[model samples]
Target: MEILPADLQLYLETHCDIEPEALKKINRDTYLKILKPHMLSGHYQGRLLSMLSKMMAPSRILEVGTFTGYATICLAEGLTETGFIDTIEINAELEELLNQHFKSTNVEKKIRLHIGPAAQIIAGFDGPPLDLVFIDADKKNNLLYFALVLEKVRPGGLIIIDNVLWKGKVYGDAQDTDTKLIRELNDSIAANPQVEKLILPVRDGLLLIRKK
Candidate 1:
């Protein structure tokens, strides 16, 4: 759920830098071809991801969810010449769609897609410390993913968790599984002394956590 009104969202999009041509095409295609296009990060969030990546300029980025590859491409913008991004998506059906777009993008060389449970895949990555980590996959596993990636993320690196608001259900009376899980994750992050966090009510809600 959006925190701002429609007019405000439109104004924000108009004022921010637009996404690259390739991302635009990919986003459109994903919405048209995919069954659940809403899962793909649209323009505004994509631009935010790109901006964060640019600011971090991380050498290694680990993304827990790679739905349609929109955010993957956005995050790839911040990589150094030889930088790399490892993105994991549990849905095998999106593999072909993701690879199709990945092949057509300029940052194709920087992204590596892993299809499987992120929990298992993350265990095998023995690479260098991550400069940035994005968690947007299974809601129930947010804390699990965060713990798994914490060891790999460099000191002061960033960890962005998407869908923390759960479409305003977080603040409502609903007690569904996903809602409870997100609430637990949010409270845990807030209480954790290892990092500093802020919940930006942007597109659902983005929890920006910085390792201390």
Candidate 2:
């Protein structure tokens, strides 16, 4: 899953801005309390998300997958004074742990946690046009999630999809279902004239698309 060499990854982490205390706790707690800790965005990618969120200064943000809320906290850091984030997670068991961390950091106020089927929940999603959206949920539904959020995003808004590379499995023939979907999503984004896209080899892979 790590595309970068250990030394280089360490160097990159070492050179980046110090990880915030709140995010540090999320990073630590997720590893300790959660079942697939690797799924949490971790320090490097968390910082990347935070950087992008701050740069965008989005008024409204939508996070399609909220695993232990690591990225949720990171993204919330960059919200405008009145900005808010709606983060959805499929696992109901994580609701308490997520809220606990959010409350501990006071980010709970800026985040609205929704627990249930992401697609169904997204179907009812309504608010100001989203200025930023991060989709890191079910791999198979990547296309569906993209379609659901595309029109809701403001022009020039960003949609960042994680794991686009699928551990390099997307490079050639997609032998599995998830790989095929991710590959298809990548191709679909590349072909779409409605958005400008780039795939940053950060962590697994981050496919960044901006609505045109």
Candidate 3:
């Protein structure tokens, strides 16, 4: 379920700021080598992440999934001078590739890659108060991740969850486990009094939650 037609998507990309050269290479390499290349947030979504980060101007960012480190870089673009991003990726196989990609960018030092289950790592995260979080990891654990990170987010901080639309499966009969979990998380967030939320029909979908 493409919210925008291919032609329109391309047109928007053309008009937006050009993607960083390093990101462009990573996008190409991801499609060529990764099993689920679509998981990588490409041009439009990457720029969206960057734009949101810039708007927030967060001092600390947490990324639950670092697939190819594309979105990680995008989010880090708006970090304050002394800020850093702690990104967790479950697949150990991607560690080397992720590091290699990071090394090619100036933001390398600002990104700390943690290769392991995000749940466990997040459970022990005692870093600086988080000003922004990007949750794009396991769908089944979306609720748990939101709970774990909510308190850590400074009041008025943002938590952006990707794939909430789950390719529009969230709208129709969602028999799959992942889709069901996403819907549950969406509903729970909507009803929760702790945060302000909105769903954006970006790439797959992005649920933005601002901690109150």
Top candidate, metric TM-score: 3
Candidate 2 regions exceeding 4 Å error are 1-4
**lDDT tens digits, residue span 95-114, model 1:** 99889899888899999999
- The residue pairs that clash in candidate 1, if any, are none
Compared with the true structure, what per-residue lDDT tens digits does model 2 show for residues 1-212? 34668888789889898888888888888777777788988778889999999999999999999988889989999999999999999999988898888887866799999999999998998868999999999899989999999989999999999999888899976689888888889999999999999999898999999999
Report lDDT per candidate.
0.90, 0.91, 0.92
Better of 1 and 2 by TM-score: 2
CA shift of 112, model 1, Å: 0.8
Candidate 3 residue pairs that clash: none
Please report the TM-score between candidate 1 and the true structure: 0.95
User: Which scores higher on TM-score, 1 or 3?
Assistant: 3
Tens digits of per-residue lDDT for model 3, 20-99: 99999999999899998888888999999999999999889999989899999999899989889999999999999999
Give the worst 10-residue stretch by lDDT in candidate 3.
1-10
Q: Model 3 segments beyond 4 Å from truth?
A: 1-4
